[model samples]
Target: TQLLEQSPQFLSIQEGENLTVYCNSSSVFSSLQWYRQEPGEGPVLLVTVVTGGEVKKLKRLTFQFGDARKDSSLHITAAQPGDTGLYLCAGRDTGGFKTIFGAGTRLFVKA
Candidate 1:
């Protein structure tokens, strides 16, 4: 079975701090996606990196895909209060349309 495991289930930091979150799995994924969800809202796609060793950036956020396609990472720089939210990583299985989600990392950024 394909499964994704995420680390550092929670994070709290002051404004301008930097942090990193990891997602790992033993199973290979065809594509991996990262999302950020705010209070009372569904997760919105932050980025999708399909190729191995791929890196994508959005403003202060950076995302990287493992060379083995079984892991991924998210790095946030100069985090602001508005950056506080739930960060999730999901993998899409080629065998089916189903996608497996990680436990999620909840971030709290203080002003």
Candidate 2:
């Protein structure tokens, strides 16, 4: 079994501050996905990276996949209060249908 570990399990910062969260794993994955979940809601898909070294941006958020497809990172620029939530990273196994998820990073942005 593979595991995904995320760093800085919790974070609190003033609004407009920039932050980066990391997700890492020892196993290589075919694809990786990032999601965000607010209180009382399921996680919402933010982005999916299929190719190694691929980078995607959504507004003030940026997502990147490691060159070896074994890790990923999420960077938020000028993070706002609305960005407060739980950030999750999931990776699909290269030769199986199983997907492993990280422990998750909880972010709180104070206004």
Candidate 3:
């Protein structure tokens, strides 16, 4: 079965910090998606990198896909209290419409 596992299930940092989260799996994926969720709201798509070795950035956040398409990472620079939220990584199987999500990384940026 294809699965995505995320590291650092929880994170707490003072405002203006930096951190990196990892997502890994033994199974290859056709596409991978990253999301950020705030309390009581559905996750919002942060970015999606399809090709192996692909990299994308949004503001202070950077995302990278493994060359083998089996892993990914997210890096945040100067994280603020507003950046505090749940980070999720999801992988889509090539053969179907199913998407599997990682356990998630919960971040807390103290003011």
Residue 101 displacement (Å), model 2: 0.9
Q: Score candidate 1 by TM-score against the native.
A: 0.96
Q: Write one digit per residue (lDDT tens) for candidate 2, span 1-111.
A: 899999889999999999999999999999999999999999999999999999999999999999999999999999999999999999999995998789899999999
The CA-based lDDT of model 3 is what?
0.95
Candidate topping TM-score: 2
- lDDT scores in order: 0.94, 0.96, 0.95
Question: What TM-score, computed on C-alpha atoms, does each candidate reach?
Answer: 0.96, 0.98, 0.96
Q: Give the distance in Å from residue 89's predicted Cα in candidate 3 to where it truly belongs.
A: 0.3
Q: Which ranges in model 2 have alpha carbons more than 4 Å from their true place?
A: none
On residues 1-111, what C-alpha lDDT tens digit does candidate 1 reach at each position?
888999899999999999999999999899999999998999999999899999999999999999999999999999999999999999998775899899999999999
Candidate 3 lDDT, 2-87, residue by residue in tens: 87899999999998889999999999889899999999999999999899999999999999999999999999999999999999
Which order, best to worst by lDDT?
2, 3, 1
Clashing pairs in 1: none
Q: With candidate 1 superimposed using the best TM-score fit, by how many Å does residue 3's alpha carbon deviate from the native?
A: 1.3
